[model samples]
Target: MYEPFFEMTNTPFRNDIDTDALYLSSDMSEVLSRLEYAAARQLFAVVTADVGCGKSTAIRRFTSKLSKENYEILYLSDSKLTPRWFYKGLLDQLGIESKFYRGDARRQLHQQLEIIHGIYKKHVVTIVDEAHLLAKETLEEIRFLLNTKMDSHQPMSLILVGQNELWDKLKLQHYAAIRQRIDLKCEIPQYDLSQTHEYIAAHLSYSGGAKEVFTDKAIDEIYRYSAGSARAINKLCTHALIYAAQRAKKLIDDHMIREVIAGELP
Candidate 1:
């Protein structure tokens, strides 16, 4: 309801992970560095962050930046809770047949990996998203798969992505071995003040809001209300814009921002 009135080319605050609008804050930069280092060294990596902390976005960026020739990657986004389901999913991803029964899926996967290792000059990488939901047996199976060897080369590089609760889950003594295998652990912290501003501005620019639809005070209030989370900031700003345009207002001020928070922004 606000595009033409505000003279914006697009909506500034869609929730999708737009890499073009990616704001490289200090914590995000550090996470990227750790991920890069781990991938280059072919080490196991664990990337955990609170929900809406941009873990999926960061991982997508990392994967896109990696050299395809040097890495054969299998990325599993929808994860199952069982070891059998996980292996079957992997096989389906690789376009390999999972004709074997669930009990034989692991062996078949190993055989497939052996073939991949033989043919591919670069490392094979498997990234499991939402890994915290993985069942104990599934996780154990993952550990075993990572332990495989292929003529001195490690079986594959494993990158597990999950929400913050993953850390607590890993703290269990029974999961110590899997935790130990994680060569690197990186957390994606919420954005800080400066980062929050940059993040909002970035989306504005993306949505053609460079003419200052949101005033300085309005931006600050957004940061305060959002608590520096990109998702939260986006939600507030998007509605704020709609609220302003509906009122035929040209610039968003503190009162307009208050209205947004008060659920009075139509």
Candidate 2:
């Protein structure tokens, strides 16, 4: 409801992944470093984060910065828990046809990867999203894929991205092989207080808010309620902006902040 009163061009705290609103917090930067390290070393890297914690955003940022001349990537966002469907998704991502059978599907995938390894002296990265949904047998199948290495060269680097539960599920004793193969284990924690402030300001700056739009008191309240989580903070702050607009207020203060925090805003 708020917009014209605050002179804001758009909402600031959207939960969606917006590269323009990305705040390079220290933790996110560290995770990016891990990704780069894993890619450079050709190791099997994995990143796990809770939902709405910007894991996908981090991956998108990482992919944008890669050296195109040396990297051939196949990103698969939907890989179910069944080994057969997982194999089929990989094949489809690589444009390799399968006979609709897991055995033949896997054979085709392995042969195609081997061919790619020889023909293109570039690194192959297979990014699997929502990996936490993968069943134990499916995870074992992934481990088997990792075993298909050519000499000292690992044909493909598997990067598993999923929610926090994926890490817990992977810790089961039976999945030890898959756990052991993860060279990089990184998690995205919630944003810190300063990060929250910067995050809001960055987005607001894009949306036409002045530096003085959010006072220190208001920012502190946001951080307190959001617990430094970017997702929560965005929700609260965005609502507060709308509150100000509804009240025809030009500046956000403790009162408006409390209104949002209390769920009083429409």
Candidate 3:
């Protein structure tokens, strides 16, 4: 509804925006580098962030940049995942039917990974997202999964990505065994005020409209309410855009943002 009003060729703040077009803040850059290192060495890594803080975006970019010829990436995001299903889920990604029993499935997955590593000369990178919700038995299975070849090396790179509570959970004494295996730890911090400003500008740039369509005061209001969460910013901006279009306003000011927050946003 707002495209013509803003002279934008495409809508801004869309979730389906291309990864190449997305903004990469400084912290994101560093975290991406660490993830790259983890993938290369087949190490265990833990990535944590606040809700809607771009954890999925960073993983998307990182996986996109990986060479398919040298790497195979497997992704799973089940909150109720169990040990048997965990092995089965990864095996299913590789087009293998898992055994009904957990132990058999584990061995079968390991055999496939070893063949891929030793023969095909390709690395397998497995990412378990929303890992904060994994049960205690499943997490213990993770530590054991890494203990192959008499605790020599891991067959595949394992990355656990979750909200901040994941790391907090790992800090407890009960989870220390798995926590000790994490070779790299990265946290995606929420954007500060300036990064939030740049984030809006970058996304708006995709619209082919003036980046200043959102005023400085408007951003201040957005940052105040969103606290620099990218998802919240997108929601607020999308609503503001529609509100502005309905009212025939090309520019979004602080009052417009406030109205959107009060009337539309929770």
Residue 78, model 1: Cα distance from true site in angstroms = 3.7
Window of ten residues with lowest summed lDDT in model 3: 10-19
lDDT of 2: 0.77
By lDDT, the candidates rank as: 3, 1, 2
Quickly count the clashes in candidate 2: 0
How many Å off is the CA of 200 in candidate 1? 0.7
Model 1 lowest lDDT segment of ten: 146-155
Query: For model 1, what is the error of residue 146's alpha carbon versus the real structure, in angstroms, after optimal superposition?
Result: 0.8
Query: Stretches of candidate 2 above 4 Å error?
Result: 1-11, 15-21, 264-266
1-266 per-residue lDDT for model 3 (tens digits): 88888888878898768888889999999999999999999999999999999999999999999999999999999999999999999999999999999889989999999989999999999999999999889999988888899878889999999999999999999998998999999999999999999999999998888677889999999999999999999999999999999999888999999999999987
Candidate topping TM-score: 3
Flag regions of model 3 displaced more than 4 Å: none
State TM-scores per candidate: 0.90, 0.88, 0.97
lDDT of 1 by residue, 1-266 (tens): 88888787877777664665666787888888888777776778989987777888788778777888887788886656577778888898878878557658877887777777677766667888999888888888888777755424557778899998888899899999988887888888888878887887777777765567778888888888878877788788878877878888988997889888998433
Model 1 misplacement above 4 A: 99-103, 150-152, 264-266
What C-alpha lDDT, on a 0 to 100 scale, does residue 1 get in candidate 3?
85
lDDT at residue 169 of model 3 (Cα atoms): 92
Q: Please list all clashing residue pairs in model 2, or write none if there are none.
A: none
Write down the lDDT of every candidate, Cα atoms only.
0.80, 0.77, 0.93
